[model samples]
Target chain A: TQLLEQSPQFLSIQEGENLTVYCNSSSVFSSLQWYRQEPGEGPVLLVTVVTGGEVKKLKRLTFQFGDARKDSSLHITAAQPGDTGLYLCAGYSGYSTLTFGKGTMLLVSP
Target chain B: DTAVSQTPKYLVTQMGNDKSIKCEQNLGHDTMYWYKQDSKKFLKIMFSYNNKELIINETVPNRFSPKSPDKAHLNLHINSLELGDSAVYFCASSLGTGLGQPQHFGDGTRLSIL
Candidate 1:
């Protein structure tokens, strides 16, 4: 089984601060996705990176996929109180299914 | 209308009981999946169905059964539930199984085993 390990399991920051979370794995992936989930709700898809060394930006969030497809990163700029949630990274390696990380809990204080 | 929806958002049940969670998708997707999220926020895929065919079945117990009545509906039934079964179950669907097709998720059903 492929395992996606996420770093900084918990993050607490103030408004307008910038932070980044990393997702690393030992196996290559065909696709990588980032999701944000709120309390009592399922995860919402934010972005998907299919190619190695690809970068995608969504408003204050920027996502990047490593050249080897074994790692991905999520950067949040000017985080607001609404950005408080759980951030997860899932990788599909053309195997059985997508492997998800343990997720990083982010708390943005206003 | 919601793209994907699951009924019984919160379920509280006792051990050794049988229960089911229903899911429906209106996105006309060809693939559907069941995922479990534990308290540590680790999401694990339990089952995946494509065109009513079982595509992937993970290392889950036999007590858990997934039934796909149609392309748009997939349901999960658990028999003799254990305390370890308590978690949030999410239903997701995608247009295809490729990497380009992102899966849309429904509000999860929180199961609490008493």
Candidate 2:
């Protein structure tokens, strides 16, 4: 079974603060995805990194895949209240199934 | 319009009772999945169906059954639910059974067992 571990399970910061979350795995993945889920709602896709060492940026959020395709990181710059949610990292292992991380809960207060 | 939709966003039932959660995707995707999020918010894959065929079935208990009547619909039925079965059930769908395609999710069904 493949497992993905995410660090800093919970984070709370004031507005305009920056935060970074890490996802690590022992097995290689064909693709990695980052999702943000608000309270009472399902997760929404933020970005997908397919190639090793790939980096994708969306506004204030930046996602990077490890060179070995076994790790990923999400960096948020100057986060706002709207950015508060549960951040999940899912790794695709060349199959239709996905292994999701434990998730990082972010609380951004204005 | 909602791309993926799940019925009974909130379900409260007694233990030992049977219940079902319905999911529908209008994105014309060929694959659909059911995930369970525990109280601690740990999400795990329960089942995956591709074009009305069972593809992935994790170590989920037999009491939890998944039925895909067609490409656009996947439903989950639980028999003799227990307290441990209380969790948020999310339904998602992707274009195909391959990597690189992002899966879209529904609002999720929060089940509370008494």
Interface RMSD of each: 1.6, 0.9
**Two-chain DockQ for each candidate model:** 0.71, 0.85
* lDDT string, candidate 2, A34-84, tens digits: 999999999999999999999999999999999999999999999999999
Task: Return the lDDT, model 1, position A49.
Answer: 96
Could you list the CA RMSD of all candidates, in the order they appear?
0.9, 0.8
Model 1 residue A95 CA deviation in Å: 4.7
Number of the top candidate by lDDT?
2
Native-referenced TM-scores of chain A, all candidate models: 0.97, 0.98
State the C-alpha RMSD over the true interface residues for candidate 1, after superposing those residues.
1.6
Q: What are the per-residue Cα lDDT tens digits for candidate 1 across B6-93?
A: 9989999999999999999999999999999988888999999999999999989999999999999999999999999999999999
Give the TM-scores of the predictions, in the order they appear. 0.98, 0.98
Q: Name the lDDT value of residue B108 in candidate 2.
A: 97
* Whole-model lDDT values for every prediction: 0.94, 0.95
**lDDT by residue for model 2 (B1-114), tens:** 899999999999999999999999999999999999998889899999999999999999999999999999999999999999999999999999988789999999999999
